[model samples]
Target: MLKNSMSVEFMAISDNERFARSVAAAFVIGLDPTMEEISEIKTAVSEAVTNAIIHGYNDTGRGRIVMEGTIYEDSVEFRISDEGVGISDIRRAREPLYTGKPEDERSGMGFTIMETFMDSVEVESEKNKGTSIIMTKTVKQVGK
Candidate 1:
């Protein structure tokens, strides 16, 4: 069992999406997570960061994104926040295949993927106040 944490701030640009994932993966190095576990974390982080860049910032790429990761005894928790145009409807946004911009050809699977990969996912936002996504996953499999 290991415990560690790290947080980073970056411009909500498309390219930095990969950077966010990398940082998240790196932060869990102390746990020596399995490849599958690492991949899940990376994928969830990617989806969250992409949402912050796209839906949160409205594709303007002028907002700020804060990503934080913490490692517990057997689980990892991630929280990604953005101070951009918040989601007007939280329930609707969490629905699968629901994208605010269909014109952009988005699949609207961000929240779904995050929830599927992580053990838990929660979203909080106001109409104009900003949004935060918190996700957690157990890194160690049972009897492994």
Candidate 2:
């Protein structure tokens, strides 16, 4: 059962990426996740937030990033969203090492990393609309 839930929206700026990561970390702390789990969640949040700022907003650094979190009895779900240029091809984007912005030295591993660390990931987007990534992770061993 979901015990807690919250959502926050912030500017899609470079500096706010850190804030997003911190928010993700704090949201799941109640589950007493392992350090590694916490790190994985943070990294995933960073990647998602970075994409929203850089790709979603066309590198304009002007937009909004919404992060919603729900805490289950032994799991957590995060939904990151942006009101910017949506993804053209989510499948191609998830391919390993398939960066759309190679010129910018992007690794293009955002979706891959999120999928690797999280138990589930779902993306919904449309041209000129926006994108929302829903990710969930289960903590097999809940701390006391």
Candidate 3:
């Protein structure tokens, strides 16, 4: 059973989204993930980080976003967290096409994209504390 983990913290800014994606991809590379798996992971990471920067911190670029990853055998789990304004209504927030900031022309599909790319996604949030998105994916063995 291969096991490893990593954690990083950075300012919540739009520019860091790509950095987050790269970090996630690097963390999983040792698992021998397929190209599709890599793409999915990167996309999911992008969404989570973007949400932390945009929704959680309101694009203020003044909060910390902590991203962590753990590898267990052929599976990987990621947790992205931000100490910013948290979600008031998680249920409605998860609904498709629901944007808290409609004026920004947000598609409100951040959660949806994460759900689609990862095997499971769990959201933990408080009204004024912060938000954390926990996601997991199992690397499929393409060939024995």
Best by lDDT: 3
Stretches of candidate 1 off by over 4 Å are: 141-144
Residues 1-144, model 1: lDDT tens digits: 447888899999999999999999888766778888889999999999999899989989798999988888888899999998889888899899999999999999989999999999999887667899999988774345
Q: TM-score winner among the candidates?
A: 2
Ranking by lDDT: 3, 2, 1
Candidate 1 lDDT trough over 10 residues, lowest sum: 135-144
Question: Which residue runs does candidate 2 get wrong by more than 4 Å?
Answer: none
What's the C-alpha lDDT at position 76 in model 1? Answer: 88
User: Which segments of model 3 are wrong by more than 4 Å?
Assistant: none
Question: What pairs collide in candidate 3?
Answer: none
User: Candidate 3 residues 1-144, lDDT tens each?
Assistant: 549999999999899999999999999988889999999999999999999999999999999999999999889999999988999999999998999999999999988999999999999998779999999999985643
Winner on TM-score between 1 and 2 is 2
Candidate 2 lDDT over 13-105, as tens digits, reads 999988999999998888999999999999998998898888899789788999999999899999999999999998998898998799999
Alpha-carbon local distance difference test for all models: 0.89, 0.91, 0.93
Judged by whole-model lDDT over C-alpha atoms, candidate 3 comes out at 0.93
Among residues 3 or more apart in sequence or in different chains, the pairs in candidate 1 whose N, CA or C atoms overlap within 3 Å are: none
The number of clashing residue pairs in each candidate reads: 0, 0, 0
Q: Tell me each candidate's TM-score.
A: 0.94, 0.97, 0.96
